[model samples]
Target: MKYQDQLKRTLEFENTPTRIVSLVPSQTELLVDLGLESLIVGVTKFCIHPASLRKNKTVVGGTKQVHFDKIKNLNPDIILCNKEENTKEMILELEKIAPVHLSDIYNLDDALKLIDLYGKLFSVEKKSEALVSSLENKYKDFRHYIKDQEKLKVAYFIWKNPWMVAANTTFIDAMLRLNSFDNYFGNLERYPEVDLNTIKEDLDVILLSSEPYPFKSADIKELRSRFLRTKVVLVDGEFFSWYGSRLDYAFAYFKTLHQDLSD
Candidate 1:
């Protein structure tokens, strides 16, 4: 069978892939949720969602730095990756070992498409369809809930030190828009670095993500004092950024975040 990935790469498989290696954490969790657990022989160290898989599955290393030897020993029939998470050089290298399926997600629709593609690739179409339907229903409900609410101008910070943020062309920005948050940095292109002093005044809310930096309550306090005009809050990065099965609960989480802020 021949399949085309989101990156337009051609993946040729003899049959449904039995030995699977997932390099992206979110996609690894999606494969498990799709009931392909036994087939996933290896995963990156960051694929820690199911928890049990971390103990059982062979660790192939992190998103950007994969141990090719470990993956080679697993003998994966299909290796899953994401363009944003894994490097192109690594994808080219993994191609030598097995068929690589690369996913490129920008918005909610693209995420759903990736889920649908995985279902066909793994022969779990029924499960995938149900999951997609459920996600769509939840999103519809969320859209209705936020229909009358004011769109809060938000600045979502993903990293510190150099101070980077989720720009217009990223999945995080798309999720923000879906949840009725107006991204203040939407005009910017990719994940761009900026000075905190320049952006503190333009936002209604300053969201600090839990991953890639692990922003906490203490960090929020410091920022809140400095950026007094903006409401500083800590958000679960997975809900906003993990474009996979995690989305099933993302809308609910977004609702809770709004309720808490209103209180």
Candidate 2:
């Protein structure tokens, strides 16, 4: 069968891929949810969704770098990746071992497209359709729920040392928008470092993410001290950034967040 990746690269497979290597953590979890876990021969160190997934599978490395030798040894029939998660240099090298299927997701539509593609690619059309239908229903309901909710101006902090934020043109920003949270730095592109001295204090909320930097209670306290008027909270980074099966629970989480803010 002939298939095209999000990057517009064409790939062909004579039979359903029995051996798969997923480099993106979210994509790995999505593959598992699509009933492709048994076929996953390798995954990156960050693919800790099932928690026990990496125990049996070969750890091919991280998002930016990979162990080419280990992946070549596993002999994956296909390598799954994401444009934002994996680097171009790494993708070029991964292609030499196996056909690479790439996904570029920025919003709900892009994520659903990837899910639908996986369903068709792996011949799990029913499962994919069911998942997509469920997600669409939840998304519609969530949108309705937020229609009347106050749009709180929020700044999502992803890193600490450099003080970086989600900014615009990112999956995190899309998730924040879904929650009806207005990004204070919407004018900026991608994740950009900001000067703490110049940060506005009139913001409604300051969110510290729990991944890539692991913001904890201490960080929230510190931020709260600095931004006395704004509500400072720690949020699950996966829900805001990881776009896939995890999204099945993200809307629910967003509802809780909305309720908390309202209270």
Candidate 3:
């Protein structure tokens, strides 16, 4: 059978792959949600949804790096990747071992397309269908709930040290728009480092993401002291950036975020 990935790459498999190596954390969680946990032979260190998953699966490495020999020994029937999560160089090396299915998701539609394709690829159409349906319904309800919300100007901080924000052309930015938050740095492409002092726009909220940098409460307190008018809060990075079965909860999380801001 043949399957086309989000990157327009085609992968042919003799049959549904039983031994899979998942390079992307969100996709790995999706596979587990699809009842393919037993089939996954290797996963990344970041795949922490099940929390106990790594105890059983081989730790292949991180998003940017991997242990080629460990993956080779597992002999994955197929390897899964994502354009934003995995590098092109990594994909090339992984291809030497087995067929690689790469996903490129920017918005909710793209995420759903991935889930639907996964169903066809693994012969789990019903499971994927139900999951997609659940997410769509939650998204619809959330949209309705936020229809009356005032669009707030937001600066969502993803990385600290040098200071970086998710701008245009990222899943995190898409999620921000879905929540009706106008990204202060939406003009730029990809994650860009910025000096918050340079931004003249009056931001109603300054969001600190809890990942990649692990922003602590002290950071929020420091920012709150600097910008007394703006609301500073730490948000779960997974819900905003992760595009998979994890999306089933993003809608609810977004709604709560909006409610908290209102309060």
Q: After superposition, how far is residue 134 of candidate 1 from its true place, in Å?
A: 0.5
Clashing pairs in 3: none
Error of 2 at 8 (Å): 1.7
Task: Report the lDDT tens digits of candidate 3 across residue range 105-195.
Answer: 9999999999999999999999999999999899889889888999999988989879999999999999999988899889999999999
Those runs of model 3 whose alpha carbons end farther than 4 Å from true positions after fitting are none
The true-versus-predicted C-alpha distance at residue 263 of model 1, in Å, is: 2.2
The lDDT per prediction is 0.92, 0.92, 0.92
Whole-structure CA lDDT of model 1: 0.92
Please provide, for model 2 over 1-263, each residue's C-alpha lDDT reduced to its tens digit, 9 standing for 90 to 100: 99988878899999988999999999999999999999999999999999999998999899898989999999889999988889999999999999999999889999999999999999999999999999999999999999999989999999998999999999999999888889999999999999877777779999889988999898988988988889988888999999989999999999988888888
Clashing pairs in 2: none
Name the candidate, 1 or 2, with the larger lDDT value. Answer: 2
Per-model TM-score, in order, reads 0.98, 0.98, 0.98
True-structure lDDT of candidate 2? 0.92
